[model samples]
Target: MGQHTILLAEDDPDHQALILRAIEETGIPCRIDVVENGSELIDYLFAPPQSDDREGGGTPELILLDLGMPEMDGFQVLQVLRRVRDDGRSVLAPVVILTASDNADHAREAYRLGANSYVPKPTGFAELTEAVARIVKYWLVTNHGPPADRSDPQYPGVQSI
Candidate 1:
C-alpha cells in the first residue's frame, strides 16, 4: 500500500536504464537503488545506516540481481547474503535473478544459491515493461514478505512457499 524499496544490481548502463524505465512504467511508488556491481550492492546493503541518508532507507523488499557483474558476480553475492550471520540470521529479503543469460545452468545455479526467481531479460521494451510490472506487483503487493526483525529469536529468513 505504501512505497516499497528495491535494490537493483546491474553493471550494464543500458540495461540499468531499461530496467529503471520498465519499473517506472509500472506506476508503483517505490524507491529503487541501483548499484553498478555486486561489490557495490554488498556495500549498500551492509553499510551502517546513516540517519541523514533518506535514499539509503534500509534493506530492500526485493533485490533484482544480474548474474554477470564485475568484482563479485551475482552467485557470490547470493552466497554472502544467504550466509548465516553470527546471530543465526541471513538477509530476509527475496532475491530475483534478472539477467540476460538464458542458460539453464545459470538458472539452476542461481536457484541453488538462494535466488527466489530467475528471469531472462526481455529483449523488447514492451516485454520488459510487462515483466517488470508483474514482478513489482507480485513481490511488493501480493507477496507476504519475511518479518523485519532479524534479531528476533523466532525470526526465520526468507522461505520458499
Candidate 2:
C-alpha cells in the first residue's frame, strides 16, 4: 500500500513520544501528525478551504485519539466529527480511543459516541510498542481502507453513515 496518514491527538508529551517511537518501530510507511489538544485536533481535521494546512495534511486514514484532553476533549471531538460526517462533507476516518482509563462506562460511552476502537494506554514502553505494532499490523497492513484512486470504478468511495 502507498504511504498513509495517521493523526494522533494526545496531551501528554511523554506518552506522545513513546507512541511516536513505537509507530516508527512498526516500520509502517505513514506520515503521522500529532495534535496536543482536542481543539487543535478539530482544527487539523476541519481546516477551512483555502487554508494553508488544508493542502498539506490530507485526511488521515486512521485516528488515534486520547479521551482526556484540554479544551474540547476526545468525546466532544467525536461528537463533532459525527455531526460533521452526518453533514456529508467528508468521510470521517475511523477513530480509536487510546486512553489510560479502564472504566467500562467510558468504553461504553466511547463506543456509543462512535469510537471505532478503545484501547487502554500501556504502562510501559515495551507494552506500548507492542500495542502500536499490533495497531499498525491490523489497521494499516491487514485492513482494506477506502480507495483514494477515483479512477477505479470497482472501488466505491467511503461514505459516513
Candidate 3:
C-alpha cells in the first residue's frame, strides 16, 4: 500500500487548511479527503462521487473524525459505518475521533461508540502538528488491529459493540 489515506471529516475551511499543513509536515504524503459534515463523510466513505476518485479505491486506511459537525455528527457516522462494515469482507479503517470539543462526556461517548482513538484538536499549530503526526503514526504505523477489529469480534480490533 502507498501512504495511508486519511479521511479528515471537518466542517471548517480554516481548520481544514491547518490540518492539511500539519499532516504534510510529517512527510506522510497523505491523500486527505475533507468533508464538511458527518453525512458527507459517510457518503464519501461509502459511495463517493466519481470525481472524488482518480483511481478505484474502496475505503481509506484511517478516519480522522470530527465529533461536532452539522447534519449527522461523528458519533452517528461511526455507528452507521460499523453497521455497514460488520462483515469481514472489506477493510474497516481505524476510526479516530479528532475534535475541538473538550467535553468529558463526548470522550466517554466516543469510546462507547467504537472510536479507536480520541485526540483533542490542539489549539497551537505546533501541538496540532504533533497531534497529527502521532495520530498517523499510531493508527497507520504502529497499531494493527485485526482485519475485522471494527467488524468481527474474533478479529480483535478497536471494537465497541
Number of the candidate with higher TM-score, 2 or 3: 2
- Candidate 1, 73-92: lDDT as tens digits: 99999888878433354546
TM-score of each: 0.85, 0.85, 0.81
Which residue window of length 10 is worst by lDDT in model 2?
152-161
Each prediction's total of clashing residue pairs, residues at least 3 apart in sequence or on different chains, is 0, 0, 1
In model 3, where do residues sit more than 4 Å from their true spots? 48-55, 85-91, 145-161
Clashes in predicted model 3? 1
Sorted on TM-score, best first, the list reads 2, 1, 3
**Predicted candidate 3 versus true structure: per-residue lDDT over 93-140, tens digit per residue:** 788898998789999989887788798999898898898889887887
In candidate 2 the C-alpha lDDT for residue 3 amounts to 83
How far residue 120's Cα lies from its native spot in candidate 3, in Å, is 1.0
> What CA RMSD would you report for each candidate?
4.5, 4.3, 5.6
Candidate 1 lDDT (Cα, 0 to 1): 0.79
32-132 per-residue lDDT for model 2 (tens digits): 98998998887776654344543455667888999999888999998988877678755666788999998999999999988888999888779988998
